[model samples]
Target: MLAMALSTAPAHAEDGYELWLRYHPLATEQASLYRSRASQLIAGSATPTQTVTRKELLSGLNGLLGREPTSSDTVTSDGAILVGTPSSSPLIASLRLDTKDLGKEGYLIRSVTVDGHTATAIVGNEDVGALYGAFHFLRLVQTERSIDRLDVRESPHIKLRVLNHWDNLNGEVERGYAGASIWDWWKLPDWRDPRYTDYARANASIGINGTVLNNVNAGAEILTPRYLEKVKALAEVFRPYGIRVYISVRFSAPMEIGGLKTADPLDPNVQHWWRSKADEIYKIIPDFGGFLVKANSEGQPGPQDYGRTHADGANMLADALAPHGGVVMWRTFVYSQTNADDRAKQAYTEFKPLDGHFRDNVLLQVKNGPVDFQPREPYGPLFGAMPKTPLMMEFQITKEYLGFATHLVYLGPLYEEVLSSDTMAHGQGSTVAKVIDGSLGHHTLSGIAGVANIGANRNWSGSDFNQANWYVFGRLAWNPTLASRTIAEQWVRMTFTNNEAFVKPVVEMMMGSREAAVDYMTPLGLHHIMGPGHHYGPAPWDASEARADWRPVYYHRADRNGIGFDRTRAGSDAVDQYAPPIAAQFNDVKQTPEQLLLWFHHVPWDYRMRSGHTLWYELVAHYTQGVDDVKHMQETWRGMDGYIDAERYQQVAAYLAIQEKEAQWWRDACIAYFQSVSGLPLPSGFAPPQHDLKYYESLTFKNVPGYSSW
Candidate 1:
């Protein structure tokens, strides 16, 4: 049905040059107000940072407001927009803003009288804050909001909002869906691309101030002097946008790059080597954001290789960087084969015991889920378990599990689910957002990092809709309290048309996308059912992987009599990790939310659901409903043909077609395999699988795109 809708549309434009920053012309009224208020600008001294800020404001105003603001030395009458810091301009000082409260990165925008002229002023404590404020002002215009009577003061809720790019030097991106890696390592130090500058602009537009530029499956060569120069060039490009570049330092860089016998933290030679490396990096890039380490996980080397703890490894790097004001983001995605414990439980077990042992400069980067980014896993136990340690929430913005780039799954709701969850560590309202932002734990430093899905694709993210996930992540990382629906509305208004006709349907489609995906892929919390290695599609019958943990059966634990992994006290007791009230709810089958029914209980096929249908029938209905929802989305988008641009409309229509096809594939494969095991007949009026179980099981694609070895 969706494929038909797309086939009727014209071919899409191949150029993806305009990312979400596409400042298309607004309605007549919006364009008029923007042009009047942002007609001319009087900016202070033109430093490198200020130049970037001026160019951005001019370009965005030209694109969005239908007029360019000319730069001026003095504020003119009536409608000039003034841009400067308190230290640079007397006008800013006279405004009497609480600049002390804004820190270095915060900004204030006010309509004030400068030299008896009514002018709008964007003032900040520093030049970088001015750049941020400039972008904020542009966003309001881009979204077609009034600029008159502007009185806005903004500060980031979290100190560090960073994007962790899993981009390798060889041009392959780990779990990246858009295209090949954006970094062209072959032509680096001398041949810097303008796209790098645009990338920095996009990050600064949202409140993201830092980026880790290498894969966590890191190469020691990144720390070498040769690559340090390459990294310095990238850093220089990003510096003006208030972005600090960080690297994923291979844990054994001391051994591989420094020719050390052992990369042990306690070894004086290794400690000295790391300190010298930090000095070398800081010398080139002064504000280098420091290291992101994936130690003792998936064959990655760490201090644990020598019977030392994670703290020992992190603190060693922290000591090296403390002098340079750098921090270490030590990843807590570790699990040991020797321990034979649940992978979900291993990270908490390893790090919870060493809470206060970490240096102040070190942050424990924990994944949003206990396991890998499954469709729906309970929040990782590490959130509230470590009070003394600053834990940064690591969210995968890439759709590795939720049908990769093909499916239109908005992840804002998923992020909100985890952030708003009551961890109950300190009290009733101990949300995960509080834990990461240092409010609940009362820690000095706080941060949140998103695993970037950005690539060389013209649209930045692979699909047009995938860009929303990236946008929402940055927005939520800036202010975790914002509702997913609100973000979705704003994104729709900016990315597409702001017309109620377009925004309402698109927002509705986006709001239900994740749940629709969960329904088709891992409904009722049955997770880890994707194919091994690539994780492209459903493989519930898969059980012959090299490690028991890698197989789908290890997660689902389905049998002829019943389905689901019983994580109650009788089973793994994973529920015991949560607070008492939450733990007790998850432990009881009757009390548990139906969304997480299969996560906690092994239920019979005939178990009655609250909806009065048998569990098996309800599962079938959910999958069918998910497919129907995709069909509905296709219809809704088709109705919006004249509303959006022809190019984007066709592009999104085509992707929706692909999504509907894959959703059917998921529904058919999962139902066939489940029914084969359950030995139950398809319920009356429920559609049967289009293909046999064996036919669906035999599906394979050895050469799928984006499955790069790097």
Candidate 2:
């Protein structure tokens, strides 16, 4: 009925309420098979946790198969999918699935003969794993993968797959393009929305096991008893989906919230306070994931404030949680005003020397790029530098610098670029993926966290296309080795249509979306030229900011003679941090990849590029080509109007129109400004800017959507 209701509506008219969990009816034959095979769900006795799992199975099956599953206490002879842990179900215990190898969160799905009847069993070593198994089975049905002869066993390669929500207590999400924060802190604990269940369902579907609920710019009030009750309610909703809730804690919480004189890590009073706080949190939410601290960075307090090391700060929290099986994720995104060195190399300079000093429960969460999440950046050098420290890769899925939600940029390729980059930690094949997944470094624990794009928008992410970024981040976090194109194809099929005519072209467009964004926003390896504070559009002319790194001009260093920052021996010597082979490649402009040519070297405008055109000419061509590509994307989507639902079709069509206008704005503004400085003529046959550099620089937006801090 839900599917029929959705199908009958005009395609363009939407509440965006369903998101990717629409579960529209399958093809006739596929629907028939699914309906028959999933006619009943025979789950174990209902505990509070099992009740949650059973509800998800029933709801998801009803939506996809067009009928509710009949549940039973015992496995039936016909048409049944059994779900439970080994201890709870005899069917699961009989499978002898080598449960020892599953660790804590792995599951096994197999087509087996149960009590002389043909049935499929989703078995696990624990109840949480059973919940994970149920979601995996549902995913197979949603993606139209074959259910016959199923023999699937999966365990997350990374220990922690988390979405770090940059949501503040005020309900405004920082760099959040979708809408307001999902957490209704004011109504929580007393009033629980059913949408929280759906949020958990969506995450569980993708194997994302954890969520850091608050903004890294944390507030001390979150630790208060009243707020803990609200957090407990959220944690309860997420628990059945195998999703644990973590909180971003302010480093000064002990002093601010606990009425202490100082928040010193080594202070006996401070240590006792954190220990008691951890005890209180565990009492409310027993499986609380732990604390995510952004300390000694962006003015957040830390041990460094008291003349101590990062390890000192992180270890203090680790000691408090070690008894409760919790871990402390200490962010390594640090910079100091006193340091005259390049901002790119600051995190490494601070954390690398204290490699083995951290407690076992502490993980230094490092961003993928040494700098902030730029459009294109070399993998952070710290990935390989810290052999003894467990490092978790932090990636931004929200597109703060990559044109926010309005632009159709799939971040799969961006994530893959960093993950596959060789760190050369142990010579060849030492990729950043291997390092964070604990293979290269042989660390006991590992993780990959994505800054979530989710908000209160009915679509989950603001635009339909932005959903693919969230989908891709989860898929990559689960495996880390999946090809970006493959993930795009899967998402296209699941979210849009399985029709080859529609899927093929849509996926191809998605595969190239990120690169197209890079070309238009920051071409030829240039980084961080977007407007300061709200990084929505072009602001290369912007130079006024309190912090030097906060300014656009601090990054590009463009001028009348040449462009780009030189990180080579003659300049910052940042290249020296890389392995010798990679260092040599970046040191020479000719040897560096054309995509990254401007990142490592600043060249004369007249210098020749690999395209056989002068650097200035090539730059103009790339910017023009980026605009042209958006035109092509518009045309491609226009041709698909008849292929998808009118609602989704027109939604994308409208966004593509916005993209085209913005693309032109990016091209015209950037080219106009760059030409003013370079003093170069436009390449032959390229269209000239509609306005001069002064006009472009004068434009300002006082009010833009999604600019509110979280």
Alpha-carbon local distance difference test for all models = 0.87, 0.86
**Backbone clashes in each candidate structure, one number apiece?**
1, 5
The residue ranges of model 2 lying beyond 4 angstroms of the native Cα positions read 1-14, 69-79
For 1-710, candidate 1 gives per-residue lDDT tens digits of 22112212233553445555766667788788767777678776558888878777776777676677777777775788888897887767777777788988889998887778878989889998998899788878877777788999988888889999999898988888888889998899999987888788788888899999999999899988899999999999898888999999988888897888999999999999999999999999999999999999988889989999999999999999999999999999998767766667788888888989999999999999888988898899889789998999999999999877878999999999999998889889999999999988888788999999899987788888898988899999889999999889888887777899989989998999999999988988788999988889889999878787789988888788989888899988878877888889999999999998998889999999999999999989989998998999899889999987788788888989999999999999999999998999988898998999999988888966567663
TM per prediction: 0.96, 0.96
Per-residue C-alpha lDDT of model 2 across residues 1-710, encoded as one tens digit per residue: 33224423333555556655556667778888887777668786557657666766777777676677787755565668888887888767776667778877888888877677677888778877777888778778877888888999988889999999999888899889989999999888898877788788778777899999999989899999999999999999888778899999999999898999999999999999999999999999999999999998878888998999999999999999999999999999999877878898899899989999999999999999989999899999899888888999999999898878888999999999999999887899999999999988889899989999999987889888898899888888989998999888877777777788988888889888888888888989899898877888999889888888888888888898899989999988888788888888889888988888788898889989877889999888888888888888998898798876788788888888898888888999999988888888888999998888888888888767567643
lDDT of 2 at 442: 89
lDDT of 2: 0.86
Residue 399 of model 1: what lDDT? 93
Best by TM-score: 1
Instruction: Evaluate model 1: give its TM-score.
Output: 0.96
